[model samples]
Target chain A: MPFKDFSKGLVKANPLFVLVLGLCPALAVSTSIENAFGMGLAVIFVLVLSNLIISLLRNMIPKDVRIPCFIVIIATLVTIINITFKAYLPSLTESLGVYLPLITVNCIILGRAEAFASKNPPLRSVLDGVGEGIGFLLAMLLISFIRELLGSGGLNFTILGYKLGEFTIPVFSSMPALFFIMPTGAFLIIGLLLGLFKKTGVLR
Target chain B: MKENVKRVVVLTIIILVSSLSLYAYYTSTEDLIREQETAKLTEEINQIFPDAGRFVQKEDIYYVYSDDGDLIGYAFKATGKGYGGDISILVGVNNDEDLTIRKISVLSQSETPGLGTRITEDEFISQFNNKPIDAIKLRSNNGEIDAITGATISSNAVVNAVYTEYKNKIKSIQR
Candidate 1:
């Protein structure tokens, strides 16, 4: 019942800042806040479900074929999430596009299943999954906030009939930094954030 | 020897169960996915051809009509290979008498983000409005449209898809 297992992922072993797992989606979907939110939720669903299933079946699986088994389990969860998201949240689905289904190949789920989940009980594994997922989400939101704000000079909280009034920066909106919206901006933001965290003794 | 067989059995059961469950989920959601897809296409069509009160399919073209049943315009999908993947565009033209470009909307595309994706922006797509279909080429290529800077391939891919499809559809309709 130790709570350290859940909180550990937030900072000490964050999936992005500290551990740097799931870097692909973290960068690819971090261009916009809404996309980051969608990608984060999808990862959480896949991670928690895969971790739970893997922990439950850990003892039953053969050591030699466990990798393929883990992949199947994660892929199945991703596909179901993909379909449901496409149906219920079509805008988020479209915005995230290829990154949504790409969750199947994301190393985060597989890495957790193999490293932490398989060795732990189902409840602990679920907590780790949730923790790591949240850690990834925090990193994504920070990165996306900088990227979207600087790149577009605004943030649109409205997504799929939901409106949270768009906020526009006075001067930034006129000439937003186009560099911050490109692929390279993703790297710069993450690198600077990681450096700042290290300077503040968060990653050390 | 017995251990080997047990290992094989466990793996087989896992695979069988996974496939069966995924198949069931697929079957259940297949219809809903199609419905969502149709709804998205209809929404996009309504956006491009705002006057479209109804749509009728004639061959490969979508004939749009007003509430009074007069033809408002026509729309059809055109796809071309782009840098990342196929770019599908919904190309709309005025009614048969006016086979000029009305509006062009990027229906689906997987082009490079930020760069090629600019193809979907208003500054890029809005250029197609009221232009002759024949003039939908890059300015560098001696046409009226300007290719999105740093995204010429994607811009050209869209222009080419629209041009090719427009020609083919026009020829068929004229015949």
Candidate 2:
């Protein structure tokens, strides 16, 4: 049963593709795989924790003021992650910039809090958060892989500010399509992916 | 009325708990954040003035000195309002009478990814090196620097900021 809760987030109700939530960070930070990964990790951390807390406090939180109570919890979690990143991963913090703090307002975290966590038990809610978070992460990686490869003509991988490896395609590296890194590219890619997902019956 | 009281009490407790946790975390990490910032500044200063052994900070300026304790040059941060946000630059000045620019390193920026952000690239920043501070305008403005092709505003922001801040800091240095 817990596995079902987690697995549903991975495909059945994928946050970015199916639920269509948290498109802001998905579009803005998907310019690079590294950035996308960093954003995904942060979201996962916030989502899972927020879900657990909100679930545990579901009964204690009054219905009339649950939204504000959830927000306070989510915002607190976001701040904690932001500070942690700033201290230990300064480079990622620099790259993530305002988007890191903006996680407080991300729809996925709040959406899960209000829709799933508020009513579910703590264990189930946590699984849901993990599933949804990973779904978002995978979606971000897919979009960014396309953008960085076609837009920048290469893929430069880094983890925690450490250079892992990098490779550039010959012709693409010389004169890549610059638009792929722009906001237009983000919209184009996501729109096409959404269409493709529908055509292949991934969305249903 | 009784239900309303419960709602208020619940919300207050949640907020109070959140605030206290945030307070604890921020206070604990404040020193580490400050240290990172200082380390970054030191690294940028060293890059701009590689010969310098030490630096003294007065207001927003750094007085850089060589290993022999001779005044090497002066370095200061200049901020320009770019297309996306404030662009920060560390401008180094030669100790000569003209106060020619030694080098400039973009410390941080939030400009457009591929266009306006080119301000941080060597091709754009290297143009500032060894030029008279007074001549830090774009070619169209009859000055030395050339603006980035598609990023005139961002390029101009850097040039204008460096020029204006240089004028201000030079006055203090002369005093």
Q: For model 1, what is the alpha-carbon lDDT of residue A141?
A: 88
* Runs with alpha carbons beyond 4 Å of true place in candidate 1: A158-161, B68-71, B80-86, B109-124, B138-142, B146-157
**Shift in Å, residue A195, candidate 1:** 2.9
- lDDT value, residue B166 of candidate 1: 91
In Å, residue A149's CA in model 1 sits off its true spot by: 2.0
True contacts kept of each: 0.50, 0.86
lDDT of 2 by residue, B45-106 (tens): 89998888989899888999899999989999899999988999999999997889999999
List DockQ, one per candidate, in order: 0.52, 0.76
lDDT of 1 at B63: 81
- Per-candidate clashes, comma-separated: 0, 0
Full-model lDDT for every candidate: 0.85, 0.92
Which residue pairs collide in model 2, if any? none
Candidate 2 DockQ score? 0.76
lDDT per residue for candidate 1 within A144-168, as digits (tens), equals 9899899888987754447767898
